[model samples]
Target: MSVPENQQEAKNKKKRKFEMPDTYVILFIVLLIAVAATYIVPAGTFERELVDEVERVVPNTYAQTDSNPTGFMDIFLALQEGMVQSGGLIFLVLFAGGAFEVVERSGAIKGGILRAVNKTKGKEFLLIALVSILFALGGAVGAVANSIIPFVAIGVIIARALKLDAIVAVAITFGATFAGFNVGFLNPYTVGIAQSIADVPLFSGMGLRVIAFVVIVGVTILYTWSYAKKVLADPSRSLIGVLDEGKEGESPLDAPFTGRHKLILSFVGLCLAFFVYATIEFQWTIDHMAAFFIIIGIGAGIIAGMDYNKLTLTFLEGCKNLVYGALIIGVARAILIVMENALILDTFVQALSVPLEGLTPVFAALGMFVANGALNFLVPSGSGQAMIVMPILTPLSDMIGVTRQVAVQAYQFGDGFTNSIFPTSGPLMASLAVAGVPWIKWAKWMLPLLLMWTVIAVIMLTIGVLINWGPI
Candidate 1:
């Protein structure tokens, strides 16, 4: 029997009203689970020693410890503690947003993008490839994930001009940066730190890494291009549909490219060059980057002829816009705090590594990749994860007949690729927040590419094991 028209319409409306949880809700649920794991997962510790001023865990030193489950009140306290711990990073996101907003308000970014779009009118693929390669090179050099956040704005503007969605913008910027970071040809954070921990000469296995960089980056370009093509063929196919609707001919792209815009953009370029130099030469951290961004914002404001009041307000407005994304970084860090407080993080590392002991050399290498990928959720920072996991894995690689270099490679694969998908990843969440793309939409679109990259990683690792790629 068919329902009445009114009743049927109501039922259909209810069925179509499914809602995905907000980013904060998803993170809070994960936090609750982490707190629960403290009770279920046994607490353990590994012997750690200071190695070149960096603390590293020692293998075969796992010992069961009394559980320290987080109390109800501590759960709430973790949020404040997380913010305190990650203050530098959180502020960096805010500063970057404010800086970029200052520049965008000056019309430099939009003007430059308009010029590029016109020049590459029919050859948008060329533009995509070039931008992808440059960002990938940035990632390859330093594992600069969070540092790439400011550039997401430029990427979005470009995507909009090309009639693409925010996902494509993120894919070309964050996704491509992560691809090179995962391969890590000369990445000081992941590859350099892991190699140092494993006693492999820094960058000793460059040949294979360089090859992996090319293949992975090639795959990224093709995947992003394919998606862009689909979007062009049918706008509805876009993962994040119609970023700017009802604002036709009202975009920044329609504004005139004035001489002042060129001057402002030139200042931005100089600031970036100095930032890279300082980072490599002086080991600048997020705090330094944050300060640098503040300078950039003020400097750009002065160059744009904005009065003091307008500039300060613009900077504050920019910060206001990114508060949601900036806060996500702190909340995400709280997940780690819960595990650390419970003392289950070491237990998790021990559990993950134990099963790889009995596997064959190639399989052990593959297992390391998978294990590190899983561990990334617990420890998302590349250098931080290296300090924690490499000491254990480095020694295990010898017993399992896997080279230390290959072990390092596995760590790079595990830590780098998964950062793009993990909610625990501050940079990934911040980039999405900057671009206005929802996490669920990004995950649904990126999962396929991630799976393909996983296959490529497995193949590369297998080859590394077979040829015994190493300098150990």
Candidate 2:
């Protein structure tokens, strides 16, 4: 081969070697690894105590029990159980999909978004920053992540209309929410549940969390806006490629915005406001949110002047579009199920904590951050992870002279930020599917931002430890 040809061949070989496996395949491999660990790592359990009507771990109560390595049949059964367990989340995705579809078909969503885009014509950066912060605030309040799923498709459409890529859409929607969630400014899922388990007053360390929230969100806006400018400058630079396929073809704004579109969009805005309010006041679950979306869809269809029959069909079509993304939730849940059934969840936590035994308080807090990130891959649910991990960590933090608040901070940071990159995360996968972007592309795009978030996390954690962030 000629020298240049040899170099080209070598590049192709390297690319092939680093290629990402299919998401399903990667998940299955992870399940197998979890199964193997069950046999290698000793099975264990932590005694539980009822704190504030919730089950929490009794610190230092971990005791090894008999090994329960899952057999092939057991793995299959676990997968089945996982799907059943994830029924609420799966249904939420479907309902939200159907609901958003109804709105889309009615043309209200696209029209309003396009009108807004046109209004911001010369200041697209302002649009990205404002929308991201709005989503981030919603996430900061909690129960907004699942609610935001229906809006994922809407976000992608808007990004394309604004001359950006699929990555920007996911970043502004899921990524922004996650950053707010990770910083944990009043996020009930992570901070509430975690602090409850740790026996700290609920939201006791709000001052620190507020500072962290601003820093994280500001960095994220700059990161996403910078990438968006690159893609706009050279359309070929877009990771999603030309997004013309499978869309409504002509610009949605080509049709003039009408009074009907205004009313419909206003109704949706009111529904979203209620969603946030009721979620905080009533502590609404996924099922409640799902039902709310269904109601919104029906109302939107009626207001947009769709006949009953047409509305029904459009709603069904929306659900059909989301089937792939919904199934990703069920399949991902199986990873947790297999680990839970094999009784390795607690064992892994115990093993990961062993190294922190002799470390200084500052290092121990940092170690907790690292361990929580590792644990996040196997257990991605924020509240679920908090319930399982916090009890053990609270006591560990005390022994190392790290405040319980810092431990909760570490836990939230670990559980929140990694979701954006982990294949096991249902929301991340679903959002990517909605945008037609591959996990590998999203992960590669997210690496720098993730590293920056980690640095922010470590720095905040260190400061918390030094300040003796305590409300114990």
Candidate 3:
């Protein structure tokens, strides 16, 4: 059965076509690599001392420990362990999904976005800027990454109304959030944690950080707006082309912006405000957040006139939609689990910090920034990374003539900016999942912005070193 020439050529082309790996596959590959590294990378540890009931790594005390290579059975065990460890965050994502679904069903989000779209028809830039700043401020104030998931739908509706794409939707919301988070002027998670460990005044280095925030956020807004205009002019240019084919008729514009919609949205706004206040004031954890989201769903459902059964079913359906995204958080955590079980995690930190000792102060500061960014891949938690690395880097900073403030700033820039692009970042994966944007698609679009931010970070750190930025 000899194939025709054209058909044979077509078959060859099909065989050669590249297909991006699924998110789970990519994560599993990372896990496999981590498991392999357990044997290859030497196991090591640092002495820790308790300060204010927190464990921090002791500097200049790196000890090579016995290798604890992960076995094949441990590979499967790590998955369960990772899920158990990340149970709180996973539940938070599911609750948020269910809550946002109830709100969407009530027409509140759609109605409000439509009204805003109509009002800003001629001035789209104002809408973009306003949304970016609000989310950026939320990020600046220590909002967790998963907190942005619930609001992505609102951004999507506003973006669609203005003929923009999903990338723009993510840009104005998630992108802006990370921009402020990376600058971290008042970010309690990264800045607060790092400063506390470094013995610098909490939230002390604000002047330069404020400038970085404005510049980074401004650049994000302009970059997003420019891409949006292009997508508007030519639909073919969209990164996620043919936006939401099945959802094209799902726009609730025909539904009038009723009193119930207003009431529902107002309650949502109040809930968000109170959520922020409680998070900062009461130091609420993800469990409290999960419970609060359930309240939001039930309240919104009742207000929307849904009976108990309908509400329950709607909530479950919403949870179902997010199952793929939610589980990914746990799977991504497995990578860290593998590293921890293998005891190679601290070795990475020690290796990264050693090179900085030999560089000039300015370059050393920049190297710290670069090192933190790399460490973020394995240890994604900002506060956790601070607890591990700050103890070592703080004293190293002093020895090398870099200010503690500058070291914390480097940690902030390193830890925050890479979250958007890293496949291991569960919140970023979840955000893209909710928006129906693939990881590869978002990465391709987000890399340029990250590069720009990197350059900005370099300039900022250089200036910090030059000025001896400190309150020491």
Candidate 4:
């Protein structure tokens, strides 16, 4: 006969298993409503008309040279510029994604990751730090999703083989990497877009961004380790076991690391050498050198025996991965058009300063952060958001007594934070969908990290105030 207490425990287990996280479908509904409202409201009408005007203000490449351009021609100019921006963004995504695919496919990435990880797997503290730096590097390249996702899966597979619960696999590998994305160094989209919008330099927040990256990564490592420990201590609570109960340690899967892999990896190394040499030796932008990496990556992948057909296939797949982001980029442009239409983009800057003119620098930073956050929801596209918001923020910085650089950092915090947990972004959703981790689950994992991060960020901003570190 089953004991009464034991029977109660079973009942509880059944109930708990049936209980699900309540995802706010309302939030999703609200987003749809907002997008719809954009077409109905007078605010939107002004924006639309404003966009029409800007369309006239900007010139087509050919039409721009004519000093006596008509209003119709001006609209043509705006449209032409918009098309160029749209195409450049697509090309940038292609290059970024293609380069990552080529480099990782060349075999150096897995080998490097495996070798480095294997050395520290058993060492908890060391393992945590390594994963943080690993993803942070991935973030810098805008390949956190494409590359980090698989790398983490490999960790999960390896962990299962070793009888470790898979939470370590998901939480440590993907989670840590996502955290890095939250505070990446000069990302093409996140910081790059925000900086561009605010008219701040492309990498204006380098010093603070690095500091934020490290601070957040350190916090995530600690949390991931704790969560992993819980899974290890009580296997029932561990999701990793459910993910791959029968798998074994890296047992030579079908994917073989080849000499071609080594050769490709070597090219990556050479590219790095050139980057270092160029940056220190010639002062090239560390941020723009990503193209060189992509070029080397393609050459190496081909040399390493990635079939020409397969290489192209993989390259296209890379593009496919970012296809949604690319589309979102276009949709985001529509919103930018709306903003430029209203002529309110700069008005936001005047609004921000008028209220907080006398507040401490820390408060001013906080105010900008909030504005950037609100801006993110409407202009979810990174580059689009920047182009919409920055022109105004950049010119008004002097009046607000806040430096353009500080405004840029605020935009970064806003841009980076929302991307981690926002529903509007396809990349985050895509990654979660691929991993079978739901959006609610991501928010659950991320909230604590983001909460702790915000506190740390404010502290840093305050310190900047004390030291007068910002550009103003």
Candidate 5:
């Protein structure tokens, strides 16, 4: 090991080819790390008490128990639980993707989008505003988690057509949804669930949340439009610029809009409207939404003049295309299952609250924001995290003299914003995959915007506490 030889070896290492790992590989590593954590991290539990017929963790009931290490076999058991737990979400992704494929194949979406793009040619910000508002409202009221999955591909294509980058497309679509969900004025999954746990009136404390939503949505629009203008000015500067084919120069519509296209587009719009209405008003589960999509696909196929054979095959093709995204959702769930089987999920939640107990009211509220943000990695589901953390968080907020509404709002803010950035988030991953953007590239591009959102979130949380945001 001469010094010259060591230097030569280092040079050789530097020349080694850098290959970005597959998304599945990264998730698999996370699964193994979680399994390792089960052994390394102490086992603990919290007493479960039923409140309002829903099981919840009793605050201050945490206790370290004898280690019941998750064996290798337990990993298999965890996988099974993950599949069972994520079965509904996985199914929704596949089915909805298939339905959207049918709609896309009909050419209605293309025609309508092309016409819309033509109208907004010079004023691209108007297009961004319109789309952002729609998606944000979708996130705010519809709890549209998997609902956005099917549209990511179309959004990317539209972004390209509009001379924008993949990041702008994501911001306009998922990013807007993330903003609305982050504010969560009427989001049933995060806000509704947390409010229920806190014993606050459902959808109460809307006054401040509405303001937060508008501010966030406005910022999202400005940020996205600014990026869009940059990319439009120089296509090579786009985050996905290397992958961009300069599709902006291509005509979005291969042909003119027809009567059939108009009818099909109208049908698709009505279906979307029904989806939002059904979700907000009737509390439609993912399964119900999937069924609705299935019906839409079949009906649209018929309207578009596709024969029975072609329709079935198109639907199947759509499902096949999304198989990777759907499986990732289930695989991501495996990480949570391992934690659950090892009984470390509660330990993770309980341990976070230790420091918050000592902080002042405002800082404690802020601490809650940080805690929920960190926990979002472990449990990405809004409703699931609300169920897991809110029970304990609600009582802790009360103990520290922070309003329960503030606690719920913190949870909402924490859970929603990270979805667009976290790799472990299935929907985020699925959307990236659908848009053909690499995780590393997307994360790098989104980091600055995420930091901006973080600052805004802090201000929003402080305002909530200062104003005593509540229906307590």
Candidate 6:
């Protein structure tokens, strides 16, 4: 009854189609469910735990909130009220960063950064470390994401063309910058705000922050290199896309090096040296970070031979990209309206903050991760998130016999990791959208890298807590 081997038959072969991860679909569903549940649960508004902090912040800015009944409509309602103003932050940072992107694309800054990343002058690893330190210094002085994000994209593009993984760009920019952001040594935003709330000296934790920066930079390089290898092997596995960076009708390496590039680099170097010396020595604050980048744009624009009018126009164009992300985050902020209505955020915290009555160092770190992730939704702003969570968390850690520094480390991991992938959070989503990558697509690449980081963070957390890294 069987057909002879060669003569009998040919069958159609089936091929597997590419599928988006189930997790991607789940993110949207979760958003919808959160929206619907907020409506079904009748409620009151969330109390501003950081209200005192906010009062001192913008000094009676109209952005203050009050509790209210919740509904599915509340998410949109929050956006309608303009409750999320991060769009402005995004706009500013991205504009400056974007301008740098175009400038680099024009071949003015790319060579300088590459020169920074890989140099014939010193050890290669040390040069990579130096690139990270400079970026972190940018953050320490209060350069926000608007600037950081575009810098990230431009750096990614350059890295890809240079055969380095874009993950290195991401890890260095986000991790080093956030680590510096957390340090608040002279950080324009959170460090000052947090110090005031903690009633600690403005630079009380300065040394620790510097250490954190080094630690995180090391982690970033380690993770980035590891992740980049897999992608280099099989491009599909990369979270950061390899872009066709050769802009339309333009050559990729048209004058990759020019005197204009060196001049801009010299101007930037002079300005950075002046800024850093002033910050550490004279303790100056002319909003120097923003001012510095602005100067870089003007100087780079000129070096690239862009006219003043074209420079100004391109600057504005770059800023436009950030608004998209800011608006998306504004949309995500609707959850706060829901949580406030449900009276759930505090309840959630109550369960978490209590009965840890006694936890070992490792368990305490684990608890911090869980609590930080959940609490992040309610107080999503990192500055605000830390103010609300850290105070309670720091005290709770004492009860568990863990150091506040360990508490801080735990907070960092929680704050830093999820932003890269969470759709409920806007900046990451917006960044992905701008790059023409979707959340689902990003998650595929990030999943493996995130797991690596998670394992590393846990290990680091134990080291912090067990070694008792902080003062008693």
Best by lDDT: 1
| Pairwise lDDT winner, candidates 3 and 4 | 3
Residue range 134-216, candidate 5, lDDT tens digits: 67876886434555766676577667667677777777778788888888775544676577657676666777888888988
- In model 6, state the lDDT of residue 413: 63
Q: What is the lDDT of residue 303 in candidate 1?
A: 96
C-alpha RMSD (angstroms) for model 5: 6.8
Best by TM-score: 4
Model 5 clash count equals 0
Worst 10 residues of 3 by lDDT: 245-254
Better of 4 and 6 by TM-score: 4
Clashes of each: 0, 0, 0, 14, 0, 5
lDDT of 1 by residue, 1-472 (tens): 9899999999899889665466577778878998999999998887878766545567689899899999999998998987797676567667766887798788776576556555675687988887788678768865245667877877787787788899988988899899999987765546765776587765667888889899999998999999999998999998779566436565544557789999997897788667756755676655677788899999999999999999999999887876776676667667778887788877776775678766789999988898899978866767656655675676577556788889999999999989989888888989999999999999998998999899999999999999999752
Tens-digit lDDT string for candidate 2 (1-472): 4579889999888888554455457567777887788778888887876756545556577898887788989888877886797676667667777877786677665465556666766788988887787678767755356556766776776677776778898888888888888876655546765775577765567778989999999999999988898888998988777455336565544545789888887887788667656755676655676788799889999998999899999888877876765665556667667767777777766665567766888899988888899977876767656655675687566546788899999999998888889988888889899888899999999999999999999899999988898753
Which pairs clash (backbone N, Cα, C closer than 3 Å) in model 3? none
The residue ranges of model 1 lying beyond 4 angstroms of the native Cα positions read 1-17, 122-254, 358-472
lDDT of each: 0.79, 0.76, 0.78, 0.58, 0.74, 0.53
* RMSD value for candidate 3: 7.0
TM-score for candidate 1? 0.64
- Report the lDDT tens digits of candidate 3 across residue range 1-472: 8999999999899899575566577678878998999999999887877755545567788899899999999999999987897676567667777887787778775566556556666688988887788678767755434567767876777777777778887888888888889887755446755776576665667789989999999999988888888887898999887455337567543446889999887787688668756755676655676788899899999999999999999898777866776677677667777887788877876776677677889999988899899978866666556655675677567556788889999999999999989877777877888788888999898888999999999999999999989752
Q: Which stretches of candidate 6 lie over 4 Å from their true place?
A: 1-68, 82-88, 102-106, 116-206, 219-305, 341-344, 355-366, 370-411, 415-472
Number of the candidate with higher lDDT, 4 or 6: 4
The stretch of ten residues in a row with the least summed lDDT in candidate 5 is 242-251
TM-score-based ranking: 4, 5, 3, 1, 2, 6
